[model samples]
Target: MTLTLYSNYVNSAGERVRIALALKGIDYEYVSVGEISWEVYERINPQRLMPALKIGDQIVPQATAILEYLEETYPKPALLPADPVLRAQARAFAQHVVSEMHAIDVIRVRRFLHNQLGVDQEGIDHWQNHWFANGFAALEELLARRQTAWTFCFGETPGWADLHLTPQVTKGIARFNVDMAPYPLISGIHKACVTLPAFIAATPAEQPDYPGRVIEPKLR
Candidate 1:
């Protein structure tokens, strides 16, 4: 049976898995869910999150889990390195973005939509900069230290770690304005990833309902 990925158009979480699918060159059915009513998604993911993939009859939720599953099941173009230490490092980098830096995008998006919620803009900006600076500082150090063969994040070919890193970097560029100049390796990897057909296929602007056109200034 063809794999079915359940996701909403232009969602960050969904974008994560989409990158993985593209790198693997795996053709799976994309089930696009919308914001209208999530009755179907709610049944699969109680949190009502996008990017819940249905592999055969199994229902998988959370972007991280889905990514790991895909890596394990389809190991042809391996996402993680063969070395255990490097593999752990890859996962660590992936987690650094997912766990530490993810909130910048979330809070920024919230501020953009519901400015009337009384969320202090100054405080939000301060918090966003703090997390982004701290997280990227460490990421820059890590990537610079890695002695690798490929231009991508881990070893060489795009893997689980790169899948997580690039999309978050894309979002950071689009939403947070995180400076990539300080992190040349990260930016280089991201630039390389975007040129690939998979990353191009997963771009937010290519989505079916991408705000009619590109939304500017991220939080305006």
Candidate 2:
């Protein structure tokens, strides 16, 4: 099976999919959208989103959807648990990161805040940080209540939650400069996840299109 992934290094959504591919030990063609011409990417995805996965002639858009496809196609590693309730929890956790936390802080949202709302850099930063804290606070409470294993969100091994958590925490530290100490469980899980080869290899800094100096934070 031939797989081609079109992604931008700076995008958290893309990073999530990339990490999943790495954990699955799937080798594919990595297309850096940042390095390529806009016309090329436009042809591939009219929406101009990063992290579009091409499986032969079929194209799967959206990072979360791509992750679900990967889990379905390659079930050996098993990103989600077999039990229906556990699977739903995993999906909800992933969605919390993507829909609740990530969706609001993406480039488009930031750009919209700056251009459309006339918000300055400080305002944008404040906005991002507030939401990050809010989401992390809720997640911390849930994890504490559930008494999640130290290794991962709901299981012994890194799964859907860990994939989403790592990238979001990475971005929170590197971009938003948020204090991770408030979310001990999240910080711990992120620390453990990044140590693995899959998470390390799929990090934004390790991507081909990464422009700036890599920020590797020492998670507390």
- The candidate that wins on lDDT is 2
Q: Assess candidate 1 and give its TM-score to the true structure.
A: 0.86
Clashes of 1: 1
For model 2, residues 56-169, the per-residue Cα lDDT tens digits are 998888998899899989997999977788788888888888889998887778888888888888898789889999999988886787644647988889998889888999
Q: Find the candidate with the highest TM-score and give its number.
A: 2
**Stretches > 4 Å off in candidate 2:** 147-150, 212-220
The worst-scoring run of ten residues by lDDT in candidate 2 lies at: 211-220
- Please give the distance, in angstroms, between residue 198's alpha carbon in candidate 1 and its true position after superposition: 1.0
lDDT of residue 43 for candidate 1 = 82
Error of 1 at 73 (Å): 1.2
- What TM-score does each of the candidates earn? 0.86, 0.93
lDDT of 1 by residue, 1-220 (tens): 5688877556777888888888888888877676435886788778676778887788888889988888888887888889999999999999998888875557456566347566576767677777888888898889888886468888667777777888778877777787778888888888988888878888787676566654543444
Error of 2 at 15 (Å): 1.0
User: What Cα-based lDDT does every candidate model obtain?
Assistant: 0.78, 0.85
